[model samples]
Target chain A: MKLTNSMEGVTIVETEDIKAKKPVVLCGLPDIGLIGIIAVSHIIKELNMKEVGYVDSDIFPLIVVFHHGEPTYPVRVYQKDNLLAIFAETALSPESVHPLSKVIVGWAKEKNSSLLVSLGGIGVPNRIDIDTPRVYGASNSASLRESIKKYEIPVMEEGFLVGPYALMAKLSMHSDLPNLLLMAESYPQYPDPGAAAAVISALNKFVPVNVDTKSLIQKSEEIRLNARELMRKTSENMQKMGKSQEYELPLMYV
Target chain B: MPAQKRMPIEPADTWSYGVMWDHISGCLEPLTEFHDKETELMIRIDMPCVKRKADVEVNLTEDTVAIEAKMNRVVQYEKWGTFQREAKFFRYSKMFTLPAKIDPDHSKARFKDGILELHLPKKERRYSVKVE
Candidate 1:
């Protein structure tokens, strides 16, 4: 519970000492369709990961997530072996996206992580018609782009990505950090466990987590029902951040 | 100084799934989005666990739309948040007030993959004039 406030507006509280050989840093902030939150949460539970640290900031909503009887930070860091996952249980405001992304990238660099992966969703209006949600990959460096190609994943060649993942990618690039963004086609304002499962399946190809997605698919309805509130709040924040820009074609591309 | 008539400002409906008592009421409010298009107001509601279109009921007025949907089965949660008690919900209900007047008679709706989309055309059409 030792909260160390940083000038970046994010306070990281490390409850346990973490030691690993080039761990992979995964971020699952509340974004479109709650894809990151659902995907990372499922991975955390399935892997039985332990909470190592938590991030707090004034820009974040004043709320505490209660699990069982213990009060937990809304944004927490969980780790198992060499894999570290940072996820938020609540929606984040637009103003917090930049500072939080910078803090996370800086922390990941300090930890000497091998790769930073961001799980998210690309909002598609026709997501209802889509059965198998497609995952698109975007990278910060050429090496990561080559890694994405090795997996046969479609590269996001042209589009504007907004929100936390967008900020994370930009900051990671500036820091010379290898960052990977996996986004699935998802409803803009609904909790999409289906899309999360698709992303997790793609992630297992590279990360080797080997998590069974059958349970995730089976419990999709329940997750959607339970996550309605967070999805609503996240959708509002997405609108404020001009997330619709992602759909518009960039003039530079033309 | 003339006293101006005050137009009523409708409060936006906030839906959340964090309430433990939401299930006890036998109904849960689904998350909804209302978009004001150029010619129509599009309303989308997330109503998962609904098996078929027959399970959903939508009622629309000039400025308000009400939705009630029955879940295929009782959704039970063993422990929600810090609450240790079990909770069960069987239905989803919500009402949305649009910003502009709509033609309820011309409104059309479609339900697919647990999402209900409503297209309500505006009663009055908007016109643009070209600059000379």
Candidate 2:
């Protein structure tokens, strides 16, 4: 592996050279409910995307993901045409989130991507009672917010977003990069493919991926069963990161 | 000044591959939540493949609860990871210990949308005091 130290304490290795003008970057790091990982993985599979690169850091867990008898990086970048996605298959340590987010956002900016989209979940305690989870949207730029309105998605008017996506949004704002965060109501400690399907449906409205989610729904149980261990590890990491802050009422709201 | 303790080091071969393999291939332990309420302890288990309440079996005591639920069918994966073999799982099983004493007879449960929720009332209730 050709490891290049792009920034302090961060190394990125490119497996293949990618060339796309103003590509849309998607951040699907493992987080609450593993929604981002599930959605982005599904999208990559449905689009037959290929892995282009990976990000590595000393602070990350000492683990590697093995896929189809081939060893692969836990956190990888995949691309198909103009759509580039960064996803982590393994649970990341809390200490790595900030630096990782900065690297991802900075790298996307360097690539001159038109937009950075973050897919994630908003944990809902009563998720079991809801048949179809609702998707909420938040953007770092006014034009993207207008695009969200044009898509007719419910805007997250007022709330604190915790975890990696929050850091990415903050960095995006500082860099003046348009970013969108699409989150769905999900079970706090389980993989919810139903929520993932809902998020992808909303994404289709904006990106026109036209990917069908019926298969995702059909395999929801299997996904939930397989993702339990990762969910457990991610839950521990989330606790370390103080994800409960998402539920707290902001002092500025008063 | 205090010196930091050095971490232990072991040979790479000392780690048991079987233990790690078994952990990776073990039966699903349904994600659960335990909430301590004023009057009761609420436990919620997310078991997605369970089709009906009949498929679930719950054994409860004053301080512990054991759950076993059979899935509607065996969930199988082919060529999983480096194993390159088929793996099949049929059920979910887990046991949890409660923090406080619970009244087994007074406990109530409801299963909906593959989620099992149990409300275990505490044996002793706390009386609240109003301050002047």
The best candidate by DockQ is: 1
Fnat per candidate, as a fraction, reads 0.72, 0.72
What does DockQ give for each predicted structure?
Answer: 0.49, 0.45
* lDDT, residue A252, candidate 1: 85
In model 1, the number of clashes is: 0
Top candidate on TM-score is 2
RMSD in Å for candidate 1, one decimal?
Answer: 5.2
- In model 1, what are the clashing residue pairs, if there are any? none
Candidate 1 regions exceeding 4 Å error are A1-7, B1-24, B76-88, B100-106, B125-132
Candidate 2: TM-score?
0.89
Please tell me how candidate 1 rates in CAPRI terms.
medium
- Where does model 2 exceed 4 Å of error? A1-5, B1-26, B77-87
Q: What is the per-residue lDDT of model 1 for residues A144-227, given as tens digits with 9 covering 90 to 100?
A: 789889988899999899988898899888988889899999888889999999999989977999898899989998899889
lDDT of 2 at A91: 91
